[model samples]
Target: MGILHTLSLLFITTPLLLLLLEENVSNVEARDHHHFGKKQKIKNSPKLSPAYSPAPAPSPRYPPSIPSDPSYGPTPTDYNSTRNCIFDVTDFGAIGDGATDDTAAFRSAWKAACQVENGVVFAPSDLVFMITSTIFSGPCQPGLVLQVDGVLMPPDGPDCWPKSDSNKQWLVFYRLDDMTLTGTGTIEGNGQKWWDLPCKPHRGPNGSTLPGPCDSPALIRFFMSSNLVVSGLRIQNSPQFHMKFDGCQGVLIDKLSISSPKLSPNTDGIHIENTKSVGIYNSVIGNGDDCISIGTGCSDVDIEAVTCGPSHGISIGSLGVQHSHACVSNITVRNAFIRDSDNGLRIKTWQGGTGSVTGISFENIQMENVRNCVIIDQYYCLTKACRNETSAVYLSDVTYRNIKGTYDVRSPPIHFACSDTVACTNITMSEVELLPYEGVLVDDPFCWNAYGLQETLTIPPIDCLQDGMPLSLAENSSYAC
Candidate 1:
């Protein structure tokens, strides 16, 4: 009985031990499956590389922030879509041959390229084409460009063409839109003979003021057009005005080199009349007459970044008598450097006229060796001399700021002569330092009966008024009182 009981106990113990071992094995298998599943998930999942690690993003390089100011929106730069057109002159048969008459070739190219849905008249390289008087009349689609790669040479010899008025002007662009002339090319007038022509040897029958006809051809002439652009060209030696824009709108002239000798008569760098929305910038002009002459009917014009030498600085009006319906307004000239010029800033109105000029501003202009830094002559067109007159028309709302320069003592620094009757009103000058020929700083002189200016104006020191002075008006009875 004892042997049977011992055997039973041993069997029971063995079974219990075996069952515990099985349970332990099952738990180990279950844990291994869970670990394997986790490993599989990690291997199959999308990998996260070092490049995509999240962090704060960097700021934009340009236009750091969206523009919130309405007035500070993106301006019209040269890179605008409206100004992107590449019309090559070479593709248009612009032969650079010095002897050949490439006028027909140019016209053909212009017609062909301009016929496209959106085309430009491109002058590819330097072309010495002899151009007779031709009219480039256009109702050009917007965004048309005229890219000049080379020079447009006028007829070299005076005797080569007919003496009639037909060949008087070499190139004429009339009634066009969105036109541009850009590149290092030149428009040479070849005016040696024309400029040498005697000024009609004698005067008119009445001995009246008959200006001599311009013997030389004009480099470029525009009439009754709009949205014109002339940039990056060396326009020189025109017997007449280098570029004349008459009765045009939205004209822009930038980065141009217009020059003639100091004695080159009637070589006005730019003459704008009867136009609106004109701008001239980044230019160097040296000529006989006014570097920039703003005639009657000019409004809302801006001229900046200009260097004028051996010429009149900035003139407004020579308006009078026969030309009576003259009006100019909202003109601004800034950041200019003038050397050895007759006058830094000038406004001349006819002794007898009926029109109004308003809202003119000249700022940050540096003048050296200027005869009259600032001059306003009511009696313009004076040949030998001028007398004080009461018949001058009205001029108003003119401002000159930050005009620092040296002047000749022989000529007064500031001469403001307004009409005694019509009166010039709202003329303001601030931070203007006129260093006399002797290097002495002097107060600006105000002419009497100039109208609407104060007497005994408080002057500021040179250093103190470096940038500019606030625009203000002082009340006084007499012009200098």
Candidate 2:
């Protein structure tokens, strides 16, 4: 070898090595700034285009600034910059290998993040974290954020589920206030094995569920929380309800996608109970059970601009079960689209129930091929053996406005079977147009003991509505208003 040959080789290789180092540095910087509200650029390499920018950070639409009623207690504000307060799960010994259990690492990271103001529990990108049945309880710092830019999942199924834990819920956030959980992440509830259990509905002969232990868990739940915001996440295949809010107030959930197979039993998209001042906006949800079911003690709740399909459309009841007293009011659902669902808008209460349901509204809704576009049944029994009773939940001041849709011919487009003892009052409907899907009406609006005022002409012409208030408002003992 000659000196000239060695010198030429060194000169050529040095520039190439320097270029590789520069590209690698850019990649590292981009990863560091991911989803943390920062900007970083990447230089071109063999794989990517020249000077490419990665996906943008998580936006500040956590509690979405929109028009709302003043009754909604408080909305969560934007989070403070959390560059120094990041508690990465990997730093606490998380493997992120998708198979190994990382439950302890997640808990530890949350605990540390909850202690500081504007603390961030960050699950970085390009990794998969597997956790178990865990609770993220808090009454801690106000501006906490959980940014999951990675894949989060649980154990494979019932066989791998933790035996010592309760099967009611997988992840719970209790007593949180002014917290924001927004991410461009995925939370995959590995629920196929649980869904295949014998106790699930329709898994037996002739549409009968088999006899077995049938305790499925909700994937994410928030209990006793206030001023919470959740947005910009994709959740799928939950064991039960995808997300539930129990006894929560001033909540805002938007830009979320929740889905499951239509055959997956009892997979409600989102269920809320005893929650107040909630706003669910601009989300898409499809599952087996109700897309959104509001239970007892919910009030001042507003749902707008949601798309639901392959779902049981939004419901306001099945309330006052077991002859209990239930008082729900001031719930409004508007500007929604539902397609191929069992029911479009329903309010059902059990017989022999006490208390009253008032000030409910469903407006500006569009439906396609729905079975029951409008229904109000005072006899909401799951089993066919429900005994008839004399007393009933007092119903009044309910309005359905501008609801246009197409329906299936199996059931009537509008059905109102009110209580025998305490009749419904002020049940108003205006501009409701419903027609059979590519067919004629096999059944008209089925009404029984319902009384209201028809301000405008109906599609099927509800002549059964007795045009006045029912005497239950003044005569019934259970009526509140």
Which candidate has the top score in lDDT? 2
Clashing pairs in 1: 87-122, 89-122, 89-123, 89-124, 123-149, 124-149, 125-150, 126-150
lDDT of 2 by residue, 54-144 (tens): 1222222323342243222222222224356788899999999899999889888887887788788888778999998776766667777
Task: Give the total clashing residue pairs for model 2.
Answer: 0
Instruction: State every prediction's TM-score relative to the real structure.
Output: 0.71, 0.83
User: Residue 438: error of model 2 in Å?
Assistant: 2.6
Model 1 residue 25 lDDT? 5
Relative to the true structure, how large is the alpha-carbon lDDT of every model? 0.61, 0.75
lDDT of 1 by residue, 289-311 (tens): 67998888888787777888888
TM-score of 2: 0.83
The 10-residue segment with the lowest total lDDT in model 1: 24-33
Instruction: Tell me the deviation in Å of residue 356 in model 2.
Output: 1.5
